[model samples]
Target: MAQDWQQLNEQVTALLKTAREQVLAKMQSPLTVDEKTNRKDLVTNVDKSNEQFLIEQIHQIDPAARVLGEEGFGDTLQDLDGRVWIVDPIDGTMNFVKQRDNFAMMIGIYQDGVGQLGYIYDVMQDVLYHGGPALGGVFAGERRLKAPANIALADGLIGASGPLVVHDISHMQAIVHASAGMRVYGSAGIELINIMLGKTLGYISYLKPWDIAAGKVLLEALGCQVTTIDGQPLNMLSSNLVLVATEKAQRDILQIEEDDVSL
Candidate 1:
């Protein structure tokens, strides 16, 4: 029998809300922090605990589904075969630890490598950006989001990873100069939300699958483009220079990069 995804969406939404609340309550106490790869890449006890809690709930809801999580608490998935859930329990661990805000919980549901549903929850603001192709449209809270205008890159703000801009990778400096301006919010989920809200024309970053998975589903549902910086399809299991933008913005940005290369 096929799964009732709408029913599952409702169930998982409630589960994520409960898990977020529990994590928030613990935030009032002290945090146990550790460095992942470097001092800039930090993780706290909350990150691990939240991933564990989410994975446990996912197991209860769909034991057959595979879960890929940031904290390494979920399954070791090599491919997106059957039912799979890609999750980031605390997306901006740095922001969560240092600023206590601007973080999110994200989940993307895929079956046979096809996206079915996506969710990005702004845990501090209690805003959820969710839905997917199967849902017919994406939503902010209960309000259905309209597809953003196809604004060109030069006319709208762009959300970018600060490091990418500072290091000038892939002519990122040139890209920033061509945009109306740039905003760095530190959380990929929040940055993607900015694009969904039409607050930013686009966002670019070197993102892992878990980082962009949920946002990719919702972005595509809203008629936005999610692809590599060179305008290639994103690999669901590998990191890439991901760009989520309106159609026109994507074309404009890629053209700008191309022009820079020619010069």
Candidate 2:
């Protein structure tokens, strides 16, 4: 069967909205939480239920599509051979659990490794940032978003992982000193949203495919650069030290030495 991405995008958007409603209803109840890889890496029953719900809906909409979900509810995908849906049901699980305000839900649809549609839903804010190459423009809620200016690192704030700064990984400290300011947002989706809205010039972190897939699609569609610290292409199937930034900020940040050298 031939795929109509336009129609599929609309259907997926509606599905995501409905999923948001379902998740919000569940949030009013007490949550059952569990540890994943470490104490800081957490998952709740909401995460599992949401992933299951999303995978089920994806199967209904496109049964042949391969779904890769953060909660392990989907397939063990080896490659992006066909239609693939990468999902993070509850990004910022810790925020969802502790704060409940900074979390988001994200999905990225790809065809043969090419991004087709992307969505990042700020569950509490009711703001959905979505679109892709197929859609031609990204949007926040109903308003179409403009591409962020190609600003320099010294002129804009940078979002980073707190530990990255504490540990001084890849000269992150020097990069921070070069930026106008810094923010530590626990959620990757929210950090990406900040960059998309021009609130920050860039965001950097060690992120898995599900954590970055949707953001990569939306950011790149808006002419932002999404790549590794060393300017390498991101592998959608692997975890990476991802950097999402404006072109100028990316160039400036990449120029810094990887060692503990001052800026």
Best by lDDT: 2
Prediction 2 TM-score vs. true: 0.97
How much is the lDDT of residue 16 in candidate 1? 87
Model 1 CA lDDT for position 109: 95
Clashes of 1: 0
Over the stretch 74-166, how does candidate 1's per-residue lDDT look in tens digits? 998888999999999999889999899999999999989999899999999999899997788999989999998889988999999999988
Give each model's clash number.
0, 0
Residue ranges of candidate 1 with Cα displaced over 4 Å = 1-3, 261-263
lDDT of 1: 0.91
